[model samples]
Target: MSSTETVRAGSGRAGKRRTPGRAGRAHDTREAILDAAERLFAERGVGEVSNRQIGQAAGQANNFAVGYHFGTKADLVRAIVRRHTAVTEELRVRMLARIAEPGDLRAWISCLVRPATRQLDALGVPSWRARCLAQFDTVPALRRIVVEESVATPSMGRVLEGMFRLLPGLPQEVREERGDMSRLLVVHTLAERERALHAGERAGTGWEATAAGLVDALAGLWPAPVTTRPLPG
Candidate 1:
């Protein structure tokens, strides 16, 4: 039995034959709602989807099921992001531990890029998470939730620290620009791949190949020379 399945509320053979109790059923409902919401938000923008649509997709007869379980759209978005990040966090921690060369820029970049690509790959085709996350960039408020749930995590912090340690000469402004650039590169690239995969179209070779390409681009991007100019008076 799965971890969630182990929470049987009744006792004896009668209990075994009995349907899942309230807690287990509620857990299942929440997961169903999350799954439906993630796909809807991915297919449509976060702002474009409604709680009623999500609840209906999840097979809930009650119109307020989404609001009851998840509260608001932002809360629902956070839940979806957290669900995926939890897995990617594990992937990143494991990748961080295996880095034999702490000074290699590509090694650190791989730590940043691979976890996300690998997570999307593991989700297989038809998964909405990457596309859903891409939509978060369209809205500032929702974007912050994405940052908090994924980029602000401890593993991500370590990856950034290691990446910056090697670029000691980078200007603060350029560093900030490169940070945003790298984030956009990773998020949209994977999202596009996910979109293609979902549509049965080609999406490069695979997630590993895609990650290698990103690591290469980022390695060069970080160390590129910056041309400073005077600010307007």
Candidate 2:
């Protein structure tokens, strides 16, 4: 081969190697942005965090790193939520498949509660995801993103379906009310536990015990008797 042709071939090989390295760096940068954003958003409310702040926390010299990688603040929140949902979803799906009895309420409830707790446990100490989600739950715009990205998943749908099937006679209004209540209980409880753990305070048992406690509480909450009262005049 001509010397110029050999040089071009070598250049082609170098370009191929460099392309993957660049892509890998971009991936790492995006992950760093997400980690920084998650912690910041958890500590402060979502409304108080900015893209520039996230970029700075991610160690980017350029202020535009966050915006370039994740676009708006809402988009960034969704990305953070999505990062964990993929793992939690896999856990839920596996748990759902292993149910020995579909009619068992506790089993169905376990499917709902344990997957999240297990995910948090796997994430280990000082994790920000649970607290971050709790913050998102309070923001109207960001709450919608959470619902669309996390709560509306197929595994979650199956969990609700199994639970509702066992409560076939439950009043629709009461069921909806309890559903919202369950969400509040789960989100805040996990967030509080996460905070306590981060602060070096005891969380009153490990993640498994915490999951069992939540399961027991939710099982009672879901089936509690409702009394009829006259409407206020």
Candidate 3:
């Protein structure tokens, strides 16, 4: 085909997809609703938002729009978590596959650590804008949903337990505590790194350079226990 023909074909495809009213399928509407929900849930805490509110924000007729895609408010919460959780899931599967023998601490730690520590470049996570949403979320249910749907996946917990067993200098309880802390630390790091990325973009500087600096900073915070004694009272 000629270059002009190719350009026209591509534009035709794009126009059809973007014009949801003309070409929209049930799945298209479902995805659009989810896209809207993800932004709203991330921006405003779940407690502060309701099913009716989500439907309105999604440009739907009534609360039924959200219910059609996801049965309940709780279900919608899970869907939102799934949007940001996908990369972590893929990373886990790939990392775990490499450690086929299982309980391979070194390889698995990268799986456990990499998802939250680095920029999600390949995926469109920058659009979900996870860092900002997570930082602002104060609703207990949203936090609980993320923890259950994303953090508490079976393989993830299994690898963490293996890490605890392999690294026995520290008690299992402390290791578990650190594991929990690691999740919070990851979220905190993302919030700070994302803020820097935004600032750099606004300043007309390269974002990749800023991302590199953030990665180095995250490496410094990895799970080496502090043996320093507490200060004397």
Estimate, for each residue in 50-141, the C-alpha lDDT of model 2 and write its tens digit. Answer: 88898789877766767667667887888898998888899999999999999789999999899899999989999999999999999889
lDDT of each: 0.83, 0.85, 0.58
Worst 10-residue lDDT window for candidate 3 reads: 1-10
Best by lDDT: 2
- For residues 121-187, write the lDDT of model 3, one tens digit per residue: 4433344455534633445666778778777897687666666666668755655666656666656
Ranking by TM-score: 2, 1, 3
How many clashes in candidate 3?
0
TM-score of 1: 0.88
Overall local distance difference test of candidate 3: 0.58
Pairs that collide, model 1: none
Model 1 spans with C-alpha error above 4 angstroms: 1-20, 230-233
Best by TM-score: 2
lDDT against true structure, model 2: 0.85
Each model's backbone clash number: 0, 0, 0
Q: Model 3: runs farther than 4 Å from truth?
A: 1-24, 84-87, 99-106, 116-119, 124-126, 132-138, 198-233
